[model samples]
Target: MSFRWVAGRIALAMLLAAGAQSTQAADFVDSAQRRVMLPERIGRVMPAGPTAEVLVFALAPDKLIGWTRPLSAAQQRFLPAKAAHLPVIGRLSGPYPTAGLDALRRLRPDVIVDAGPISAERSGFADAIQRQSGIPYIFVDDSIERMPLILRSLGTVLGVGDRAEDLAIYAEHAIDALRGRLLIRPPNERPKVYYGRRPDGLETALPGSPANEEIDEGGVINVAAGLGRDGRIAITPAQLRAWDPNIIIAEDRPFYDSLLHDPIWRTLDAVRYKRVYLAPSLPFGWIDDPPGVNRLIGLYWLSTVFYPDMTQEDLRTQVKEFYDKFYGDKLTDAQVESLMRYAEAKAGETRRVGGEPLVGIGAALPTPVPGPGGVGTGPAPNTGLGGLGLGPPGRRVPTGGMVPLAPPTPLH
Candidate 1:
C-alpha cells in the first residue's frame, strides 16, 4: 500500500543488489559491456530478467519498478509477500518485453538494468533506447567469469560501489569454494555427463555453452562433447545411444511418460542403470536460464551432485541468505531441496534417431514482436525464412504436424 511498507520489507533482499531510500536517488546507467566500478546509487531500476530483478530486489526493493510476470511457483514461494502488490512488467513467453516507453517516461526511472540478453536480441540496442528516453541502460553477461564486471558496473551506476564490491568478492569466494571441492582428474576418470536442455528431452547444449562451462567447472565430463563447441546441438536418439555416456543429466522432459511407455528409449544403458537425474522446472529455469547472477546457486547444486560425498551445508545457508536478501522471503529446508531437484541433470535411457540439430536460429533471430521492447508486429508467427512458427506462448500445435521450436527457447 505504502512505499514505506515495501521499503521496510525489501531492505534486505540480496538478490537485487539494490540499495537506496525512498525515491530521491536517480541516475542514468550505461552498461555497454565496458563494465567498471563507479560511485552512483541508482534509485530506480528495471529488471530485464529474473536475475536482474533479484539483484535489484536484494539491493533496493523500494527502487525496483516491476518484475517479469510468471515468477514460477518455486521462485514466487520465496517472494517478499509484498511482490504480489507489484505489477507484472510482462510475462516471459506470452508477453513481449514489458519495459514500456510510456511507463519509463511516467516512472522516469534513472536506469534500465538488463541481465538477460538472448542471442535473439543481443545487439538490438535496448540500451540505445534508454539513452534516447533520457535513461541509462546496463547489460550484464550470463557468465560467472563476467559477473564481477557486471556487479562493479552496476555498483558505479548505482552509487553503491562498496556493496557492489562486497558482492563481487562474495561471488568470487563462493565460486572458489565450490571449485575447491571439485576432484579434477584424467579425462577418462571424470564421470560422463549429458545435459538435456528443456521440456523436450532431445535438445541439448554442447560443451562450449555457458551451461556446460558451469558443469565443466565441477569436474564432470560432458557427454555432449562430441556435439562440438558451438553451443547447443540437436541429435538423434541413435546418436545418443552411440555416445552411451556414464551419466545422463536429463533436463525438463515434459513428456517423461512417453520415454517409459515407448519401447524405443529402453535400449539406452542409462535407463537400464537408472543413473538419470532431473532438474526442477520453473524456478530451476531462473538458475538455468542465461546462467545469470543467481547461477551461483546452480553451481552449488552441481557441486553436490558431482561430489555426492560432500554435504552442501554452507551452500544451503547461502541460498537462505540470497532469498532473504533478494526476495525478502524464506524457504523451508524441504522447499530448497525440491527447488534443486529439477536442476539436477540425471542419467536416463533414451535411444536415438538422426536428423539435423533441431536447434536453429530463426532467420528472425530477433523477430519483431509487438510489446514493451518489441520492434514491430504482424499476424501470429510471421513465418519468415527459418521461422520457428512461435505464434504465441500457449498456442497449441497439432500433434504429428509441425511442432514449433521443438528445441528449448534460447536462454542466452
Candidate 2:
C-alpha cells in the first residue's frame, strides 16, 4: 500500500472506533453540573486524585483500577488485601499531578472519577483530560453534608446502588444525630477551635478548606476562619495568640507533642487548659489529608472533642464499626485502641488545674465539670473518651470476621 493510503486507513479506523464509543455512551450530569457522556458499562475506574481514589475504593473497590499512592504498612493493615496490593498509579488532577497522558492511555480506564469540591476549574480540568485521553471523566462532590447524595448517585452509576444506599443511610444518620446534638448549643456556646498542621503547628487550614471540614461540622467555630477561605496558610504566633481559641486540633504528631512543653505554645489557653488534641492519621487522616469519605468518622470524633458532654455512644465501638463498614477491615481491639490511644488522653497526664479536675483531659471524672470552652459540663457518663465516641449508634456490623468487600447481592 502507498504511504498516503496507509495513513488514511489508520485515520478511518480511529474515526470508526470513536463513533462506536460515542454510540454506546450515555449523557450523565456530574456534580460539577457538567454534562459528560459516560460509558454505559463502567468497569475499570481511574481515580484522578487521592480524594477520588478513597471515594471510589469505598464505593467499589473492584472497579478501582489502582491507588493514587502506595498504601503504607499501617494503611494496608486496615484495608482489604486486594485493595492494599493494587499498583500505585500517580494522580492525574490536583495541585501536583503525577500521572501522565501515556499512563492514562495504557490503563484505558472506562471512566475517570475525580471527587472533591466542584468548581469551574475542576470541570475544565476534567474536560481537558477527557479530550486528551478520549476517556469520560466525572466529578463527584465530596462535601461532607452532600456525601449521601454523592454516594447514592455514584453507586447507581457504578452498578452498586444497594451498597451505596447502605453507606448513604449511615452518613445521613451520623450527620442528623450530630446536628441534633449541636442544636443544644448555639455557635457562641460551642468552642472556638484552631486546627494546626505541620510540625511547627503554625500551618493551619482556613474555612472552606477540606482540612477544616471536620472542625466546621464538629459543632464549633474555626478560629482561623477570619484569615480567609479555602487554603492552608502559615500563621504567626501573634495571630494564634490573638485568636486564643479554646481548643486546638493538631495534624502532626510532632506538633501535638511540642504543644505540651513549648513555652511559646504554652501561652495559648488551649495548651494551658489541656484542650489540645491530636488528630489520628493511620489508614487515613481522620480529619482530612485527602478530604474523602473517611471524614464521616471524623464528624463523630470532632464532636466528642468539641463537646464531650453531648456524646451518646462509646468511642471504641464507633471506631471498630466505622472501620469495618468503610475500610473492610475488622480491627482487633488492640488495633482500635492504638488508633485512639493519643486522641484524647496522654499517657501519664490527667489534665488538672490547681487540683480541680477538667473535662475531656484524660481520665473520666465522676462528676460533670466545666469543659475548656466553659460552655457545658463534661462528657456524659461513659460517653466520648479521647474524641473516639460521640452520637448514637446508627448501624452495627457483625463482628468476628472481615467485613464483606462488596455489598450483598440484592433480591429481585
Query: Judged by lDDT, which candidate is best?
Result: 2
Give the range where candidate 2 is weakest over 10 consecutive residues by summed lDDT: 393-402
lDDT of 2 by residue, 1-412 (tens): 4443343334334323433232246666666666777786888999999998988888888999998888899888888889889999898999888897999988989989998766678789999999888898888777776677667667767877678777877787677656667666443345666788888888887545677666656545556544445667777777777767777888888888888887878888788878888888878998997788998887777767776766778877888888888778888988987888778643322222222221211222323323346543323332211100112211111101011122222211
Output the TM-score of candidate 1: 0.65
lDDT of each: 0.50, 0.68
Residue pairs in collision within model 2 = 315-388, 315-389, 344-386
